[model samples]
Target: MKLYKEKLLSELQLKRLGEHQYSCSSCSYLDKFLQPYWNWLVSKVPLWLAPNLITIVGLILNIVTALILVWYSPNAKDGAPRWACALCGIGLFAYQSLDAIDGKQARRTGTANPLGELFDHGCDSISTVFVALSACIAVQLGNHPGWMFFQCFCAITLFYCAHWQTYVSGTLRFGRVDVTEAQVTIMLILAISAIFGPDIWSTKIPGTVMEMKTFLMITACGIAAFVAQANISVIFTGGIGKNGSSVAGTSVLSPIIPFSMILVPAFIIYQKSTEHVYENHPALYILAFGLVAAKVTNRLVVAHMTKSEMDYTDLSLIGPTMLFLNQYFSTFITEYYVLWLCLVWVTLDLLRYCYQICTEICDYLHVELFRIPHTGNTNTKRISSTSTSGNTEKNGTNIRNNKPPRSKKK
Candidate 1:
């Protein structure tokens, strides 16, 4: 008996230990970091102090930066004054930090619904467009031709699409941990360098060949292109399906879709590198024409297949075509128009994400339909029934009286 009891106790302890181990292994750092802040913000702040408010604040700051670069400052023709440039840089930095905070707050407070993540990323995307437009405005103020704005627009689109493709494919990693912090830092530095004049800024290298802005843009673009190609390869080769199945291509031409997707961007990047052309250079305009040709040829090859047969092939083709079109638009669009367009795209995306989050929250709570509770009436009725039953028992009286009690009814 003693041995059995000891064994049972030991088993209970082991079970608890296993449960604790599992919990620790599954703990998320994001939850830990954001939870406290979320609690404090919600409890301390006014109802009006919400995530959207933070987004608006960030947008306002971004717009102010753009306006300062466009209208005021003696060096508007070259860029903004050193002070205005500094202000813009500071504002951008703050905006990014707050952008992060809103999401963290949402997650920590158990409010990390899909809508919050969507709203946060949507805001981020819009902010990206705004930043690009501001750069265009600055460039225009600096006496650069209006066409340069198109280049900025293209760069933004490329970045956005690359991220989107990666997100969809589940291969999109942002920084060291596959988050967006590193990318944001890179963007901030690029913005700062542009403000300071790309040519004038130099790092610790004894003799670096590339200017700061040029190097930043090239590096960011190169990374984006590489990630995009990797996602395309995974998608087309069916190397990894969304449902975790491997798909074998039935036709020899099936592989070509992903092949072109990866190769075309690669060829463009290599061509740009060898010719010493930046992403926004006139060369991209020519490259866009070539990509369009490639896209048309690929479509023609797969055009004859049945809808179901062509589904996979079509999926592969869409990304390349979109990339080409994006590049074309970037190369051809006017600066002033591109900036506003980007801004509008960002705003709409943000709103869509917020709505999505709210819907998710409602679903999670299982409160699709509103229901009211009558706590007072239900509690009062329960209490009255209990009191009457107690009184009947004490008085030797049964309410039902189906059978006689030994001492009373008999």
Candidate 2:
């Protein structure tokens, strides 16, 4: 009996080795000046206000900003009025302020927890799309479908890569020039757009015929390539982890497969929708962007909370690239046919992915994934620090005690 208990305890310890504690390293030049403003703003907020509520408010502002852009720019080609850029700029600025303040509120209220981090990140992921699409509209990039697709793809992929780097390296890195810096640049561009009318800004570059929007797109692509390359190098070379080891196996591409596959249906649906109902409807494009943003955000929440590695895979890029290429070539294939096929593929894969993550988290916590407590609320309670540690120890004890005894007969 003594030997059995010892062996059981060992197994329990291994099973209860919970996720790595979160860590981050940031070098923000703007924060040096912005910190004082942020501190003052956070001080005015009541302590009773929850941090997640702040995140939700930020998200709503993002949606509203996108809506404003769509409403004013009914024809995607003619572009939104110059003043609309000012509204989007205001909305995005508010979003950034709210997003930054939430962490401070969490610290002030003594409610900082992993769930809060997850919630904040989830909001940021979705907000990325809204902000990107809004900026695209403000600059009139949406007038060119190719550039529009490229811009959105780069923005979304940039976000995914950042999280992917964090998940694998066990460190969230904010380089000297990061998303915050890029955002400031974008805001400046929007301000310029508002100050100088779109027609004037759309004029050819000083020395070149390329428009400012195209130049901005090119610059963005270059920056994205650099950032993606750095993260990909760290993934393949095993440079960032403790003791310099890779988090994923030799096949670094497999994990990205699921995320990429999920977008297949979205691409097809987007194409058909654009062809039929959204060709002239700019608002639908914003709505489409929001749907994708929501889906990707949900996926990231599951990935981060579960501490899963998101692989660096090219397969995920192939579908979107191919679809875009087909559009560029004006393919004869009917989009509806492809859309139906992609619908089936995406549904099956999404269900499987959700079920797998749900089962893993539930089993890890030793609790029902969707269980409603006697409290009669379905909303998920934040995983407090005490409960997290307690659950680990409790799960370990239950597993150890549940082991069957060896047969008496020998």
Candidate 3:
């Protein structure tokens, strides 16, 4: 079956990185000043280790850190333990360090490949959910459900948008203000929270009822909006106007399908967690964030590999729209029932898209998704293996036909 494209092309054919120089223009000054230290740390990692392995280790560390937070701080009310927060901070620092060095390591080892790029981005997606949920627990934002969801949504949306910029411009353009910068800043916040105590973020602003979480979420929203707009401007105006490439068009409402599947369930799950049955287990909310995070990541990865322009329609747009509308009608109708109906419709649509994308990728690559090697050598092997075996068999049969068969019979 023909998938999005035919004829398996090597990664070289799909090259998008011009000059192949990896630089983060929007990197925070913190990362910039610390570059020497990060370089020193990368130099220490043994040359024998694969960059992809380093990425996997970073992903594992992130998961472990998140698990520790959930175990220690089940409820936002109980507050995260000092030790737990410290452990998370350490893990975040380590993950960030490793993530940074992997590319350098790959370049040093001469193993830089498309698979490594895909692996790194995929892990980043998963880590986004874990880190966001951990932040919610650390800050006890679970008690403030809206803020908790908002943080997760904002973080995930920003992460996806960064990659979407790459899909549009054929280069990963880090905005003058970017997520990598925010990530380091967040690490600082985590460290501060660990040192001061979980209640630090909960402290009220002077002369106002709003807490730190509110201020932070609002600020995060502003940053996310700016970053998103910057990307959209590039996609619609700068890149497309120059190149004449446009994203695949679908019905206006179709873009909402995958997003609703994610956010609708998110609202339901958040509401249910607030109820008595799930109140103590706020990890349920984290799981909800994971669903949306995975969906966004999946979309980004597909766009990157297929080299297709991603539709500008994103869940981040719909989320705030629904959030605002919910406020006006919240008292008049049972939101749960409305969410339940949305849940059913969204789940069906999401599943359908997931199946289509998965199958298309598998068919296109002709390799197990997980088994695709970092080097494009696997494609070379598949293309030649059959011919190599056929030549061997043909040679053997000829030998038999000439005289080898008679010798065997005797």
Candidate 4:
């Protein structure tokens, strides 16, 4: 009767989680210039507003705008209204801004903890799904659905691998061109669609034969490849734990299995549907699978944060399983409708997982989800974002601090 009442964390998981501390490092190309803007913006946030609430608000803004795009161009074949394109850009910028500020807000309000790290990254996992899908639609990439699939799945994989290495090395690393650079690039693409119409992505280059969208796709995938390589380099170089073990003392390669399970099924389901389930509704199709990505990615983040081995059994698999089963049984159920059913199922599953997990974390840690612990200095002076950690925009919000932990008292 009470799904939220379910306990997702075991006693050992709780113990390890209590000992976890956030550690991450980022070297972004634009953090220096953007730091000033973020500092000025957070200064205006009411001290009384909870940091988690700020994160939720930003995620809502992103999801709502992304849904608006989906409603207008569900198939990704049609050109969305110019205003919607611009609105998506605005919404994404709002998300990036608020997300970056929430972590800083946590520190300012004296509330930065493992919960902030977990909460922020959880939102990022979901946001990454929507961000990739919205960008595909903004480019009207429906004509090249395969490329669109590549684009969306590529983003999901990048986010997953980012944390995978974090699990291995006990440090979240960001290259000079990472999440911030990617978000800004997509925002610029959305803005271009708004100004010149989605057709701009279809235009031919001046001297080359490559279409603008193809060019963009090549560039995005190339950068993703580079980032993924960086992650793998860390993995191959060995973990920070004893005998090159991951932080959890698990096999460095163990994470690959769980991530592949989520991804491989999506590909098989998409390719096997005789009813053209994906072609008819690319956005919905990806949203279904994307939620699955979000679910597992969150688990990986939790695994890293808790420094515990992850159990790969997830309820979100029910969604893709429904689709797989429907196709295997001679399409007893129409795939288009099954896709819808799948989307609804995954959404609820993700919600259920997050609710149960967050409740457990909050209770065990004695933390509040949407309220600051100590209320005072309704308008206290905030830290200068410029001098603070430059990579604060990566994890869930931004780059996490990489400073070594203070030695515990004897």
Candidate 5:
């Protein structure tokens, strides 16, 4: 706790945060078709249920199911049980349904704010890593680590680039076949694995000598490359901010340094390892690096919303640096143990950053994290810091407005 004594957001950033609005342009073909279903699903949720609760629950479900798969096939090369794959499919579907409705729940309850957007995207950055990992395991992609590395990093890169574009243009853009399609395809792949077995992915294509899994990997990687290029092109075409800068009024290309710091070091460590560290423990290696990537992505989201420049330097870099230096020491410590230490370090760092940032935001907005301040009934006295400070500020554009009820004359 002492580590987070300093404020993460500056006064200027906090002031500009109120001016931020969530602007998204999604041309998702699948989501367009599923609109009515998503609307109907959210309608079933009770009024008292908190939006952040909905999001966290979905994220937990996704993580738990993915972990179940990891427990069985830690290396991704081992074939997982049929039941586990089926369970993962169900869990992913639940997560998708619940994640889709949190925003609606917030709006319905009059608790819509920048916090909701930040929380939602923060959940997504982590979820992307798990989702990609689970898909790789489902296809038994561990046998081919080269493809596995490309596939997992490709997914991560595309996710980062999407938000990078948002940081530049001040609007999130989605093409026709984006996240929704990829998720649905993965869900189906898991379902097929559960039914026909993981070995089915090794079968040759109907008319071609290529394996089924290879085709899948190649196609997904190609699509990811195309999308990432599109994002960079949007950045190159210039931004929507003043003087063609990012939403934070910084140079549009500035984000490249932070992200490259992550990807470049990861590639170097993976290739230069004398003990074949990543090849021996693929899942653990990916998860550690994935968490680091997620942390950086979350910072990018915050910078865009706060209209503040994102610092390329981060404490999370300590994890990668430790590994890189360990390899340089000529086997001073077993690489496996070092990888585990790296994972633990990055995880705690992520949690700490999230806690401090959310605490600061909640205090500033006079709102609670998961609870809606009840103001309709006078006798319904819910006493807490959030409730007491509910009347702090109700005029801000993107901040929540907590209002008490008016009295009636007899």
Candidate 6:
């Protein structure tokens, strides 16, 4: 009888062990791939001097580079003091490295935060503006036409808008692993070519085919515009019909909106791509025309909303109305810097609100907003083991030792 009881208990324990083994394997797959690298880095570096410090270092380097570019602008006219340019290049390279290192360090230390993400993106935006401005200054000193300043300004503005659209839509992505590295290589080639003149490369390759820098810039702009528009469309569509009203009408308008957003930028890209010739592509022209019409319609809707009275208690309604009014006033009357600063503050506040909403949703669903390591599996195992032990004790006590011995009568 004791032998049978022991065999039964052993079987139950084996089954429980098997279940746990399966659960642990399934739960740890993702962590398994990353854990080795993470552990190695954590062992090497103190937590206090990890990712955040890298970000700060990157920010300082970028700021110094911007300042140097501004200071060296006058001397850039005699073809930018080679040493200053070299320093700027070195700073840019360092900035990129630190940018990459911060994320790596964060992953290694398992210390990523929402605030870190926000700060990283915000700093990147600021860095882009500084870098573009510096480049504009250098170009101006290089005897380029004053109009090139406007071109650079427009290019930078479009790039920022595209980046923001993707970020807000939750498709914010980086191409540093491939495209950015390739771009750096291309820039190196361009710097070398610039020193020797475009004529040197033009001789080896046909002049028409070898518009290297122009082609590269235009291609980059085109790709960025395309991706931005695609992601924006996805976001707009997803948000549609979520509020009280059906977004059917809005949905109908969505396909045309992105085209309008990219129209001017697309035209600029095409013109640059084709070397400033006005080659009429009917489809592109229609796309440009459609964008203008959409913009006009959007403005009309805004004007209508602003002119109407809205109940203050309806915060959702009032908020949008206030935003429209602010936008209108800022565009027509307010100092540009003041308007921009206000807008930035508002954007940040809105992001904070959205994050709170997401947190609430995750809580309601009983799921994590971001991955939490091992907690779920650990809890499940603890519960299972406790329950199994309780069942075994209950069954063991219920068994009558004298009754069990009666089986030996056969």
Q: For candidate 5, lDDT tens digit of each residue in 1-410?
A: 56544999877776666556556555567766776887798899998888889988988999999999999998998999999999998888888888777766765776666676778788888888899999999999999988898888888888888888889998777777788788899999999999998999999999999999999988887888778777889898759788998987789999989999989988999999999998888899899999999999999989988888899988888999999999889868989999999999999999999888888877766667888778674332322222223224322211122211100000
lDDT of 3 by residue, 117-197 (tens): 555666677678777778778777878766666777767666665655444554455543554566666677678778998
Candidate lDDT (C-alpha), each = 0.36, 0.55, 0.55, 0.80, 0.80, 0.36
TM values, all candidates? 0.44, 0.68, 0.67, 0.91, 0.91, 0.43
lDDT of 1 by residue, 1-410 (tens): 33112121133322222121000011223323444554454455343345445655765786577456545422223444555555666666656545545533332222222223223444454455445544443333223323333344344444443332322232322222122333244345546555665334434334766544455455545655654564455444432333533221234234345434544553453243432232233223222322332222222221211111222232223433443444556545443233234334433433443454334433433222112123233422211121222112222211111100110000
Off by more than 4 A, model 5:
1-5, 376-410
lDDT of 2 at 14: 21
RMSD of each: 21.3, 12.1, 14.1, 5.7, 7.2, 20.9
Better of 3 and 5 by lDDT: 5
Q: Give the runs in model 4 whose Cα sits over 4 Å from its true position.
A: 1-5, 374-410
Q: Write the per-residue lDDT of candidate 4 for residues 188-283, one digit (tens) a residue.
A: 999999999999888899999999999998898788889888989998785988889899998899898877887888888878878888888899
Deviation in angstroms for 182 in model 2? 1.8
TM-score, prediction 6: 0.43
Clash pairs (backbone) in predicted model 5: none
Native-referenced Cα lDDT, model 1: 0.36
Model 6 regions more than 4 Å off:
1-47, 74-78, 136-147, 166-168, 174-217, 238-410
**lDDT-better candidate, 1 vs 3:** 3
Candidate 2 — which residues are off by over 4 angstroms?
Answer: 1-20, 239-251, 262-290, 308-410
